[model samples]
Target: MEYCDGGSVVDLMEKRGFSTLRIGEAVAIILQVLEGLTYTHNAEIPNVRLADGSFAKGRGLIHRDLKPGNIFLANVGGKQVAKIGDYGLAKAFDQAGLSGQTMTGNVVGTPYFMPRQQVVNYKYTQPDVDVWAAAACLYVMITGYSPRNLQDQDPFLAVLQNDAVPVRDRTSAIPQPLATVIDRALIDNPDIYYKSAAEFKQALFNSIS
Candidate 1:
């Protein structure tokens, strides 16, 4: 791991003397994270044979603990690149079952960013959970508050009890298109949720474009 001179996004917020970062800056950083996630969610792991002597295809990895504090900024060729770090809670979905560190039915993640489904089934959480956390990071970056207000409530129960507040509700300055993208990504329902990081990234791109 290389050193990041610009520090984490949390550090950036502190340096700015405000929790919320400029919308443009926050979007830029999150776009990079989405790009990283696009690759992570579609990674192909080789050399694993399937049931009938056939190698399995692509493998997807989920970073269950994605937050502003875990995203670090590094100077690369005069550009500040946002890199996803602290993959301690990362899980890969393949034919070999859960990875080494994964424990079935045990919840482990930052409550503020994770969706309710993740809390319910952390071991089997899919890539959309990471996408939701990414949106949560963006929410805090631009709105200066978490999607759900967890004050005076048990952190664990808060995740199961509350849905994310709409971005525009927290701050009306956000444009509807951007807010809609964030809101849709944060939806906990299975039927109408962003299924993958690429899906969320495309929605975000379309909103901006």
Candidate 2:
């Protein structure tokens, strides 16, 4: 909370367009958020339930609902940091060990971040799903626009089922490598994308380095 700011990233973007940022600065902002989530998942969080199998951390604490509004922005003295806030209403659940499922309260994340299965009432892992939302947010931040146009009734379905537009189509300013990261994150194939925030953070830093 030390880096806390009273405004959201969307507020900043609207006031000052993101299209002007160089790819390096864009990666820097994204790396900060990814690293933060990675740290939390890697920490010893108390009372978090584990998936009955595999014994690996079950997506840590699944943030059931992550959206531009729920996200908070702060500057570690002008370096932007994002935190998953409003956990007061989210439900964390045990992850699938090797491959199994469990009950969580039936609710879709915000229309923009909501993944397809969630909209259809399918059970999904907490952290895995959280990774999905993070990926979506990443797209918005770098492009100054939502990846999905939000022009449809079922935004998640369109976003999830339809192939993602080429990142170049999304933004000429986005570098191909970083855009590739966002593309993989929102892709239909899980094996092609990072399953955890930690994995995504590593890829991001790799790009920067």
Candidate 3:
């Protein structure tokens, strides 16, 4: 693993008391993350073995844990670059044969960043989970607060009840166009949410244009 001299985004936020970053800086970091996800979601690795001892030629991976803590910043080519890390919870699934729930019976990922479908059905296989989590990260970057501050409540119940306040409601300074994109990503209905990281990135870019 390459050394990240700048450390994780969570560390920076904690040290700086979660101060909001400049809009350009925030968007840049988000775009880097989205770019990384785009590769991970589309890359095809060969000769992969599954837990069932089955062999497969190619598969796309889902980074189940995608909070700020799992994202690191490093100075590369004289510029700070955000990179996804901590793949301990990553899962590989067949993108071509995406079938019914492949995971269940246990909760995964950070509560504040998890999507509604992930909480209700852990086995659900869809790239939207990461999209939603990335949106939560964006919310933190802009407002310095989690989309839902459910620290005191049961995370499962909080997500089930859809207790998060809309990003627009939390801060009026956010541009309405950007706020709309973030709000759409936070939607519980997977069908209505950003379908892929590339799609989400495009919407984000459009907001700042």
Candidate 4:
């Protein structure tokens, strides 16, 4: 493990007061995380064995837990780089056995960052889960708060009830287009949300351009 002298993004936010980051800096940090996910989601790894002693390669992995605390900042070449860490809840999906659904009765991931699908149907592996979580992270980065409107109600219940305020409504300083991108990524509809990390990255880039 590389030493991240800069510490977690959450630490930085706390030290400087959240929502103090410049738009470019916040977007750059988030793009780094998305870039990491682009590789993680597509990387091939060994799959678990089946009852028949048969096994296959898993083509996609989901980072069931993604939040500010899980993201580290390391100084690389005199520049700080955000890196995704903590794979404790990561799960792999077999491409050959992908039925668009996986069984799971228990909820995982931080409550504030979890997507509605994760709260409603814990039994499934979807890349969109990370996408939504990443957007939640972005919200915190830009607004100093969770998208769930934690000040008004319990964040866990808000997530379970799909009660999230639009990013634009939370922070007017954020560019409307960028806010829209984050909002769309946080959408509850997997079919309509950013489908892949690459797509999410592109949308983010477009927002800044």
Best by lDDT: 1
What tens digits encode model 1's per-residue C-alpha lDDT throughout 1-209?
78999999999999989768988889889999999998988887554344454655548678899999999999999999999998777766555444536655668889999898888877667788889999999999999999998999999898888888999999998989999999998898653288877788888888888
Output the better candidate (2/4) by TM-score.
4
Better of 2 and 4 by lDDT: 4
TM-score, one value per model: 0.90, 0.73, 0.89, 0.87
- For candidate 3, the TM-score is 0.89
Off by over 4 Å in 2: 1-3, 17-22, 42-45, 48-59, 77-79, 95-105, 120-123, 190-192
What is the overall TM-score of model 2 with all chains considered together?
Answer: 0.73
RMSD to true structure for each model, in Å: 3.3, 5.1, 3.1, 3.3
lDDT of each: 0.85, 0.60, 0.79, 0.79
Model 1 residue 77 distance off true place after TM-score fit, in angstroms? 1.4
Model 4: residues with Cα > 4 Å off, grouped in runs: 49-55, 95-104, 150-155, 190-192
lDDT of 2 at 200: 83
Please provide, for model 2 over 1-209, each residue's C-alpha lDDT reduced to its tens digit, 9 standing for 90 to 100. Answer: 44457466566565574443345655565566666666655554444344453344333455656665666677667666766566643433454322222344445457677555455543554455666677777776666566566675566657556555566787676666777777777764433267787788777676556
**TM match of model 1 to true structure:** 0.90
For 1-209, candidate 4 gives per-residue lDDT tens digits of 88899999888887885545677888999999999999999898776434344766667778878999999999999998999998867766444332222333666668888887777755455787888788888888888778876557666677767656888787799988998898888887544388888999999999999
True-structure Cα RMSD, model 2: 5.1
For model 2 the local lDDT of residue 123 reads 50
